[model samples]
Target chain A: MKRNPAALFFVAAVVAAMLFVGFHSARRAGSGNSDSLDVTGKPAPDFTLDSLDGKKIQLSSYKGQAVLLNFWATWCGPCKIEMPWFVDLQKEYGPQGLQIVGVAMDDASKDEIAKFVKEMGVNYTILLGKEAVGQEYGGVNVLPTTFFIDRDGKIVAREFGLQSRSLFVDNIKKSLSQGRAVQAQK
Target chain B: MQLMPRSKSQLAGVLLLFAASALAQSPGKKSPSVTLAPIDPVSVTRGKGAEVSLHFRVAAGFHINSNTPKSEFLIPTALKMDAPTDVALTKTSYPAGKDMTFPFAPDEPLNVYTGDFTISMMVRPLHTVQPGKYAVHGDLKYQACDNAACYPPKHLPVEFEVKVLKNATPAGRNPAQSPHAHR
Candidate 1:
């Protein structure tokens, strides 16, 4: 029996292509959950959590305003450094449709977080962060990770670790400008 | 019937292709997230002080915070050594960190270490100590972070053996060269 060399080569090439495609698709499917949440230009994941004052706050309620969502903990050193900056930004940009929300990813008691908030004079809304909510936001593993969302609830940028006050202000300005553009379009 | 040389060559070719693909898919092909490789140990005379160096590597795209954090509250990378009674740790020296600016903090520069770095320590033996082999344990504590997020603080344990020898000459005379001297 004679085997055609051309046929063997074609079969090998097809097998290689199929294997490559299968590997690529498997990798994508494995990371789909986190990728969908963290990808830029996608709508931010919405959740409802109780504020420090026992007010049920829905993320979608602030859709028309630019939002800065910060996931932090009381024990995190970087969180302490940026809490003051958040307070200042809330004061400066609140009138311009900026809403800074802090989700405390802490195991500390509510009184501890409240005391820290009072001491820092945080002017923004503070909510207790749940592990499930953190997972939904693609795992807030780092302390002081922040997401900048535009007025349309689309995440524009994500920041990790301790960020400078100027950087936060710059992001806020960008988000606010995006809000104006979105309003004009509506 | 016996197989022809061409048929044997074809089988060899197919095996070679499979081997290449398997090598490509192996996890060892990827760089490790973090690693601490122990360098050659140091030898010292009793009551004399000496230094030991260790190589530390952090994967690309990730950085560990520096010993001197930008803020007071941030967790700083620290190296702690557990020395035996005979072996005393005089001091530990850390290399200067690279100043990096990320998009999160474009203006303020943070001190961090990426890629490969070295941590060295000065150790001295007590005067009453005898010549022997001693194991020194150490822990490197750090918090790793990338552009997207930060991970919890991790403590990596490392150890290296030190061989202490008795002085051959008088107390004031020059000591002999170490046989295990690192290049």
Candidate 2:
């Protein structure tokens, strides 16, 4: 039997094509898992807003620490429900390089937010959220949307709507562990 | 080139694969913000008016903007109905909204409806219409919002049937039974 070089070349080309298509499809699937507002493993959008105490706070300033960026409002019932958990988490993890940043999307004045914070006994940094900033963060359509960012400012998880305290703690733990791993590598 | 035809076919195959994958990756349909309960059928006589109440319950932790929102950009809750030529929709009255004050702007108050609320619709059947069963189809347009953020506006469909009876006059009937008595 004569060896057909052309047939061998055709088989090799078909195999190469199939492998290329499989790799491309896998990459597309991986990227598609990320939400437009909360793209995991991507750099988080940075914004500067004034705190309830009249101090300017920049999201990027906490680059080396894990950040729990929560968008909430004073009137949101679920937000009220989750705020106490956030307060406890802040107290428990603040010393461990966890920075919780609360962005108030309220139509009320800053004084009202400050009063609410005082009433809730929130110890973390609370910043005023602007419509533009909300749009930048993928149009925070629900109250209490939270983003967990690692030490490198990359979003590790994006939670929409009200979540359980344990879910939040788990994501925070993951982000914090990733931060430590990166630090160890450095 | 000798390979031109083969390369062209290969390119076509790749494009077809890309189109199929793109379609598969499209987002799924979103669920409605408000759910409507099945309205009980109402009975009315020809040449008389009646009131029908449709109940709507918003999703938990969400409120639909009132008929009159504080800002123009905010979408106000509204109802529209489709009726036969013989049926006339007189008016629709939304329930009163609760005044809510948020921390973002304490001075500016927002009007919103939370939980379960009813919208009363006044419908009248023309005298020229014959007695029969008719279905009224309508939809409620509303933008659901929580204290922290607002969602895109959604439309919820509503439907109910009304049985029309032949108008009859009863002598010495009780005032409560008289259709014109209320009017």
Candidate 3:
């Protein structure tokens, strides 16, 4: 039996290359879901729930508009801090096809949340979210889990904590600009 | 039976490779050594003027958030006090926190605490108290994670002793020691 040094080098190179490709491809494939829910570059999971105004709203109904869906509770300090920014966003971009939705996660009765909403003067479309919706949006383990959806109804970005206005704006402007292109194509 | 020559070194090499990979994927390999300070068990004096204070010293770059966690999924730090039937415990308070985020995943960030944060428990002296060493125990529940992965929450049990004097100096806490004293 003869051992060839060149053959050993070639085999080693091939093995290293395979390992790199396998590791990176697996990592990329794993990014579509966060905490076992579809939240990135996928059609968001649709749910029908009662809006604060007593109207039944299904996520699939807002297919042509960019949606900023936020999960928050009144008692959460971080959520309270970001509520004003969301209200401002609704006023500024409501006409631009940007819809900001707040899904209250508090266990308090609707009357309690309505009182707080009135005190805070929140102007966006707020609704109540059950534990099921939290599971659908990747187990929103934190208050103020907000998702940015493109006009075509695909979630593009998500923020897990208090929303930063600048960061939120950047994501919104990018999505809106891209949405215009998407609309022009249709 | 014919004995064929086999390379013992090759078999040993294969075994070593398997062992190395298994160790790399073990659960305990990702955490640093966390040491909890000793729980000093003591009893308070039985008198109308008895008071107690519990103290904790978190290691650098480690902190536990207030009872109301800054975000969901993150465990909030807690303080539980056990004393005689006559003693009264004061409500606890936590200092403010700087907004910060941790990497729950490569692309997702979770709000959490960083750096040194402190929690304190105060017990007021009822006019009538028993003269004994009052023992109190509690844990600092926190999960330490950097910009990368988060380790499981660790409950660091911490305790302290408080002595009651006939005319205690109001137990004025050290400015450098108390959580409120820091700011």
Candidate 2 pairs with clashing backbones: A106-B104, A107-B104, A107-B105, A108-B103, A108-B104, A108-B105, A108-B106, A109-B106
Q: Which residues of candidate 3, in runs, are more than 4 Å off? A: A1-38, A53-56, A75-82, A107-112, A162-167, A173-185, B1-38, B44-52, B57-183
Tens digits of per-residue lDDT, candidate 1, A48-152, equal 998999899999999889999998876464576688888888888999889999999876778888987888899899998898888878876666778899998
Better of 1 and 3 by lDDT: 1
lDDT of 2 by residue, A42-61 (tens): 78889999988788889999
What is the Å distance of residue B172 in model 1 from its true position? 12
Each candidate's fnat, in order? 0.15, 0.07, 0.00
Model 1 chain A weakest 10-residue run by lDDT = A28-37
Number of the candidate with higher DockQ, 1 or 3: 1
DockQ for the candidates, in order: 0.09, 0.08, 0.05
Give Cα distance to truth, residue B96, candidate 1, Å.
Answer: 1.4
Cα deviation at A68, candidate 2, in Å, is 0.4
Candidates' TM-scores?
0.55, 0.51, 0.50
Task: Give the CA lDDT, 0 to 100, for residue B78 in model 1.
Answer: 88
RMSD of 2: 12.3
Off by over 4 Å in 2: A1-35, A180-186, B1-31, B34-117, B121-183
Query: Runs in model 1 with CA error above 4 Å?
Result: A1-70, A73-101, A104-121, A127-139, A142-186, B1-32, B168-183
- Summarize candidate 2's per-residue lDDT along B1-183 as a digit string, tens digits: 566667657656766665554434332112226888888887877787789999999866557778987654456799989987798877799989888875433677778888898999877888888888999998999866554444446679989998887865446879887667679
